[model samples]
Target: MKNSDQTFSLQDISPKGLERSRKLTHLISSEIGATRQQVIPFDRFMSLALYADSLGYYVAGQEIFGAKGDFVTAPESGDLFGFCIAEQCAEILDENDVAITEFGAGTGALADTIIRYFDGKISVDNFNYSIIEPSPHLSQRQKIRLSKINSRLADKIKWYTTCPSEGFFGVAIANEVFDAMPAKRFTIQRGEIKELGVAYDGENFIWEIIECSVIPELIRDQMSNYPEGYTTEHVETQGIWFEQFKKFMKRGILLVADYGYVNQDFFHLDRCDGTLRCYFKHHLNDNPFFAVGLQDITTSVNFSYLAECALSAGFAVDGFTSQAKFLIGNKLGDHIATLSVGDSVDAYRVAQEAKRLILPSQMGESFKFMACSYRLEKNMSGFADNERFRLG
Candidate 1:
């Protein structure tokens, strides 16, 4: 939020209105095994706070996943974004007849774009899509959106609360999904590392240092070089999730795009605080404890871990590149040209959105694209122009 241009009022943090704050607080304490004053690890607190049934941020009746929600995804930004992705997806599925499984399929706009593009071209009977969404509210919204776009396409798309039990083939995509997984927060304190946690003081939640244990080797490797007082976060969820997701894919590609860094860049020595952040309305706040369930709390991903996880889980690391390069390489120019901007105002707006998506100082450079393939060819349009290092 500090570096972002967007702003939101303190009042808007209450997504379900401030009335539900008590219910959220009560649910967190009950689900996380917290006594009246006992502390819970930050990761545990985050998991429970963001995902605890109907009481959590995503499920408990609030407008999320759009401009009306806390933040906007690239798909929602414009149809151009999803069209570019569909271009890549279409190329992958040209010969291979398979299902496209999308994790965190918010608003189903990407699916709409894919459907619109391949409507008459691809046989609807051969093509299928499954959205892995847990939130009933969001799923309902997706149904409405998909049906609005095209009822036939909606019929082809199925909603799954869990991964398909049978082995499947095709591409899997999760846009900005990994960053939402709960991460363990730790700080280098007095030459020793301490885990950051949360405790309720009857009136409010406060930060606390929970007992330390044998840290995950991944965390230790990165934190060892940081100076004392340096704070950071790490996640094992993507690796764990990949183990399950890959089971559904006998052969396909996994495309992950989110703002993240390689391990080396993630734990930069000069970074005093890791990339943990909260989004309420459009405003950014570093404190996850601020609005609890109402605000979205997330940390930047460590992409290096993802590649390692994919390899260990039997995926071949295919391509890794910046969002800008990926877009440029994947015919962003073509997609932009397809837009019909008649008026100067609309043209100017389109230009601004493209600039934000492709500019180095904006979302483009900060977000990265990683492709992990399973029994599929590695060379693809998304990474054709990934060679940014050679520019200098």
Candidate 2:
């Protein structure tokens, strides 16, 4: 997956890709047709569209990262992002026997960057990298990419289809991961909360407002505050995910980096349509039903809700801040300085990447960094003087 300099539109999809999408559509249509109510919850639909067996988007053996793919992640932009994260890990794992467990290791770019950055900083015997990736297609890509690194670094890398059953100490990184989790879409209709579901209309998938029989406790109180037809998302599975994470993390930190906002900004009154978005090629759209399993569907995270889940799961809310501040706090400037003394062309490239990472109009302010710890007392370096746990 090479870096993409040009913007990609939906027109780039090939005939083969369309056929794969059609197969996935048929599979989803069949499942919805068999449902008693002729509709499935929005989260269920999203899960099927993105994670249903071999036909799902992530498992369909298609490149989904970098310029030629749907969208580019921060790590894909450059290595500075990974370098900063590696610095944070180094701070927390100081002289300790710990492994870095990364979730949804896309293309293994970040893993490769972090592992290589740790070459002289941490001893190989004290450091290991474990990837918990579910998509076999992506797993293959990661394996191929990481194998090119030094044999010693490659030997320290491990792969898992699920979280490890045994407990270990270290850091857990989830970069742009939680946003892909299936989220329940809800809207207020006739003064009551109703769930938006997906229904097959014989030709295309359509929206069906089903009665929300049991309101989620997290949003029950705010249900009445929204105006009529106000739509938003709620993720109840975060607590369950934390439960699983806690099992393997005997004493460590879970670092989450993604685009999100605090509760007040997340469910703001003016923002009615919610944060659900779909990416086809590089073009963005509000409709998730457009490409079926061929596109990426995601929703912005609610950090406040995530904090509630962490507290319930016995984890301490250690720190929270924007990605820009976190990176700056973690010595992004030092990297830029070092690179500036290198080849002139390389310095110019690093400058462009740094702007994209720290500029407010780019991913800087939009993305957030959150740290949740379990039985660990040390504060992470990325949040030094920039910690905003109160906002979380």
Candidate 3:
């Protein structure tokens, strides 16, 4: 195919982009010799997708929420989603003064709602707020929104460039964070599954499937689950993330909300093309090569692997459920009940979106909720009877 489009492609990299790509190319060629010219590992591709200096989609200053951004997350559903999460957080706080550390908090919408909810339920002195955001652009946006809140609550808010220090205790929450991690994609050629890698292709970056000799043996061993002829892919970064989570969390809850499925369901024979997707201006694009650094790239999470990693990291699997089940079980219905007393139109609109968030056909069933903890004896209140909860 002709690579003539200048809308957004490898050509858009400009002078600085070419220099960076040349440096990366030299680094790869030196490490792996000429074979590196044909294929670069999936992890490297992920780095480009997310953190390629200025061109990376997440690293760049692009709007990433609501109808205008690349994609919409549950938090974009508005205060209803935030209120539901705050309700659960309040229960966890109980009598202790705890800090709420949110990962990849986009636009601080959720944080704003959380602060409001906590303010209404308890004294502001009882809470401390912190957000871990990597993008300088997004962090500035968060500061702008957060400044509108009372200075007392706003002052309590802090930002971290990386994860918090080890042995931290409190609630660690992430909304749609795990899905953004770089995932390794694989395809079955002949009878052997090979990883897809990126290369310079002399003119521009291109993908090539090659043997995965560099991946850790433990991760490579998991490929045994695939059928003899079936091709599969895995998120190699998920394991690394769990280890990081274990190191930071000494005793507290780790709540992750994202779109994913169990291993069996995720790698079924029907899913040949894999879960890789690109989003630009609210439109889903399958070709990751098209947008380069201007679009959002994501894949579904593997809950089974996450559960196993958490267990190995000494975390007790408190609960595994859908976002819908967790929200309803935690009393989203109760929140809805209160909506009728106010502006009925706005309340109804919020209620409708809330339903879409939790319904199986929409995001509810597709999105999952997984929680793990250390030193906590009781089960997570929000996920109780999670398996039995039906999608509405």
Candidate 4:
């Protein structure tokens, strides 16, 4: 579909445009059963943000990374991040005999970088590579990018529509994947925390904080520990993903890198607005009602909650740290110094960008790394011994 048919343009932000947005909002609210007096629950809100037909961001085919995209990811920073990750993957493969599966392989940039790194660093004859990408557009892109490497290695790259079952041993990596899962939003009013529900407001779309008195006992049980007046957002799909992960991997390492905080940090009084965001053409848009399905909507992951979920699913926590500490622990500086020896300025520029990715002020501090092991007996490689930190 053309951008004009689905997304809001500059003109769409005007009075008439606002009217159009209202109409669209009304349509969505009616579909989701939201009301104007209440806030639409976060999970339903996220469903609209991510999967609202062709209008949803991920389904809309908007440019998502690089200068032309909505935002830049670490893989787009350069090959170094992928190379370093590949080094870690090699360590995992060295210790266990299993294949490598990467989830949500956006643009296949990371896969290309990883394949190149593996080709140069290890013998490909012994290992298999797989990618679980639900987006056909990205899967096609990955196929094209991986073609530059040896065809034999490229052939080892398998694609799965969903995560595999019965568990395989190896490394499973997800970069910026969990944050995209649809989440439920709630707010505290009159000292009662209520779920925000979506509904039509006749002229426009509006939110309603409906009393979820009929919510499943299991879900209610999970929320029993929430303190009074503690309004927060929850990714209802997170636990489902964790269960899938456990079923898919018998014994291997699971690496996840994303921007999020622990429970105490995320649920503090200052975080009432939650971490919802929309990105379009490298710009951040706070109003989800404006763009409909054209912008990427995401919220920060709650790492502490994620860790607990993983543990409940039978995975042992390996390590958790900021990207900066993780890279420094893995000796990123040495890699930069080695790459800088080349005469090409392009190579040097790439190295500099890689440095920026790991710098404290940029993605380094904001992004975090978490590793979980399932049935692995040995310590996973990549970081110095002293760099390891407890998740709790």
**Model 1 TM-score (2 dp):** 0.92
Indicate the residue-level lDDT of 374 in model 3.
Answer: 83
Model number with the top lDDT: 2
Give each model's whole-structure lDDT.
0.78, 0.86, 0.72, 0.70
Please list the residue runs of candidate 2 whose C-alpha ends up more than 4 Å from where it truly belongs after superposition: 1-12, 96-98, 386-389
How many backbone clashes are present in model 3?
A: 0
lDDT of 1: 0.78
Superposed Cα deviation of residue 9, candidate 2 (Å) = 8.6
RMSD of 3: 4.5
lDDT of 4 by residue, 1-392 (tens): 01222344656343653444344455566666545345456567667656655455565455666897778898887777887787677666772343788999888888887777666454557667889987666677778878777645567888886887656778889999998888776655665556766555555445566775344333354445555544456786777788888888888888898998876677656765677777766667555555665567788988877887898888888777787776666556666776667788967686677767787888888888888889885555454442234445
What global local distance difference test value does model 4 have? Answer: 0.70
lDDT of 2 by residue, 245-346 (tens): 888889999899999988888888877888888887787778888768888999999999998888889998888999999999999999888767878898
Tens digit per residue, CA lDDT, model 1, 1-392:
13443355556544446666668887666644545437787888888667778767777767776678889878887776777777788778764374688888877888888778767766667788889988787788888888887536557888998787988788888898898899988888888788887877776777788874557788877787668888998786777888998788898898898998887688788667888888887778787766667878899988888778888899987788889888887788877766745687767777777888888898899988888889999568888866423211
TM-scores of the candidates are 0.92, 0.95, 0.86, 0.84
* Ordering by lDDT: 2, 1, 3, 4
lDDT of 3 by residue, 302-379 (tens): 787777778878887777788888888777887777654678787788778787888889988898888777886555
Query: Which 10-residue window of candidate 2 scores lowest in summed lDDT?
Result: 1-10
Candidate 1: clashing pairs of residues: 1-284
lDDT of model 1, residue 80: 69
